[model samples]
Target chain A: MDTKTDLLSHHISQQFNNELEELRNNLLSMGGQVEKQVSDAIEALINADSEGAISVCEKDTDINAMELTIDEECSRILARRQPAASDLRLVLACTKASTDLERIGDEAAKIARFAISLTEQGEAPKGYIEARHIGNHVRQMVQDALNAFARFDADLALAVAKEDKSVDREYKSATRELVTYMMEDPRSITRVLNIMWVLRSLERIGDHARNIAEYVIYLVKGKDVRHIGIKRIQAEVFDQ
Target chain B: MDTKTDLLSHHISQQFNNELEELRNNLLSMGGQVEKQVSDAIEALINADSEGAISVCEKDTDINAMELTIDEECSRILARRQPAASDLRLVLACTKASTDLERIGDEAAKIARFAISLTEQGEAPKGYIEARHIGNHVRQMVQDALNAFARFDADLALAVAKEDKSVDREYKSATRELVTYMMEDPRSITRVLNIMWVLRSLERIGDHARNIAEYVIYLVKGKDVRHIGIKRIQAEVFDQ
Candidate 1:
């Protein structure tokens, strides 16, 4: 009788593991799609490729569908399995990662919107260089954040967080440049304002990347480092 | 012997209930604090009260500390009790709601930053009314979302979602007004741009409220209605 009970427990554990494995794979797939969207959206704006921007917008449907599916799966696991400890944390992380990925999709859609406006304006001024520079920095930050999440690498996540400062500095530079362009010629203000919105979107994308990094810290250290100073988080997580 | 075992189970159940009660109260407290911060921040902007914004900033430290404490408590309950079904959902929802509150705090801080900038600009144009309109709308949506969460009212949550569209429409109006302001006098572009940022921030606050509402629907119906149209969600939850 004891042996039968043990066997039942083992079977249940195995099924839970399989379900968790499936969830992890699906979340990674969704992450990959959003990462691609961010880069494609940046490229479209820089190259003035309206087609690429439109394509990213079209692909958003798939990202949305995946987010919904993962959310449902996570809810099912919670309802049916009553996961605890590390297993529960994994499911919780998936829910959060799904929300972040969906927001990244929204950011990409925002970039695409800017691309449409830029195309309508025919051509942007020379200061477009500054905007692309900031975009590239933001895109790289997002890529590194996603990679850190995939590997559960705390150091990589820290690197992503540290890069956010530089992204902000670049954003400030881009803002100044755009404002100067608007001030130079009033006609340029319309196009420049659109570009500024794009810069704000990229800057926000960087902020989201920082948010993902904070989650990675939580996942690894079981600490809530968010809203606390980063210096304090590093001391608690690393120096300890 | 059976009676003794039942007594032990009852004691354990009571302990679990106490933990869940603490979690619920902590979430409500955090919700109340965050709700106040958002409203106060907008009020500071409208009244050009830097002191009010500063007060909000100072209170953020307390909000952040509360979030950390709640996160730790939830983690402990999950680790020790291994609650199932509705209990598990309650803990998970508490964690997610805590996160939303933290982000709401961030948005309030952002609104304060905009207030500082607007104050420095000395006087915004006659179009400040548009920003005020959207700010009021977003604030109401947030308040309504929190009310829905406290009562677990799916119907109230759906109403919050519907109200989000009106906030979006207000945002569009603010944009049109600001853009026209900038076009009329190029010198006013900087001042107008700052107001636009405030409008954008308020719009984002509405988005976060929508997120909270989505979680409310999920909590009530045990369905992942996120990414689906809000109308469908209302029908599915209330059409019975």
Candidate 2:
């Protein structure tokens, strides 16, 4: 997939253009790895595949490396090219987006680690359905967030932000049910708590995806749409 | 407090140096706000002070706004001055640090939310002592991290990293004990889970503080010390 967002507005210096282009591509590359890590981690948890989970853990280093590389490129471009206006926003967004992606990757590794630990103690009585349901939603959110960045689509990014609300709702409801189940059966608390942590990680992944989307909105619209509600973001970003 | 870090060295442009200086000071100011939020949130939890918790929640917006403002200034300095070498690292570090401080503020708000929830549900049978213990430790870690950035002290930053290990250990042991308590007394699971979440928030706060400290190491030592273990960061960073 071509990762260039075409957000760059044709620089005179071909070298500078290439530097900006490479920065966006590298960020998307990191995003792809993170999206896969999240997907594989959820799969590992559902299937009780410890090896799969460990592999997810191992691949995290690559994502971390990608973040450092992309961040360095951002600084390099800022220092060398002194990019202004749209170009500066792109660099700033890439720097912030890479951090968000790395965090999403970290959360995925955490879910995978939970999978490994869960495998050791054997499967639980409940919560895999909740995991799969919320897992698919969050995975899509992460993927869509990256796509939003790749295409520079604030509308799609807005959709990602809106989906986070639903994902969070599902997470809270699932945790409440699990808490009730634990109260009914004391033996299941530990395993259920592990599942709860997985749910928590999934919820957090959705949040980081929302963050990336927010950065995209800022990139394209040049507005900081955070802390404001969806209605305000809608009115602010698209209206202008 | 003077937040310059004195790490800028001798830049030719006094205005550029002032911009860098203001960025650092603004970041430290944001950090100060975050530190207070965490402390207040923990205090609210221990005292069941809903008003105090609500204040922490309210103050979060200010921190969030501060993050955007400082981030904007970082880009401004990057674009206008196009600082290189140590100046470039300072800008990058400021960008990353603001994000960490914003996240730390988010975690504090989360803890405050938990505090408010716990107030509605009434106090749990266990976990307050643990909250007090880990809360103070994490609060100290946040302060030390900001100081490390302010002073450009890698040694102090390393100490913050090491302290995180102990904080995690304390957190894990507390959660384990709480888990045991919940299992033994099934009725306490809900309240205990709330306290557990407060601990989770505290743990994440420690992680963010450690991240800020790691960025300090990078700014001072010009090394990316993430994912590497403590001893590795210790030897690689301080060896020179």
Fnat value of model 2: 0.87
Cα misplacement distance, residue B52 of candidate 1 (Å) = 1.3
Docking class of 1: acceptable
Residue pairs with backbone overlap in model 1: none
Off by over 4 Å in 1: A1-14, B1-12
lDDT of 2 at A47: 92
lDDT of 1 at B16: 76
Considering only chain B, report the TM-score of each candidate against the true chain B.
0.89, 0.96
Q: Mind giving the per-residue lDDT tens digits that candidate 1 earns over A106-188?
A: 99999898888798789756556776787778777777877776666667878888888888898887798788778778877
Best by lDDT: 2
Clashing pairs for model 2 are: none
The TM-score values for the models, in the order shown, are: 0.90, 0.96
Error of 2 at B91 (Å): 1.5
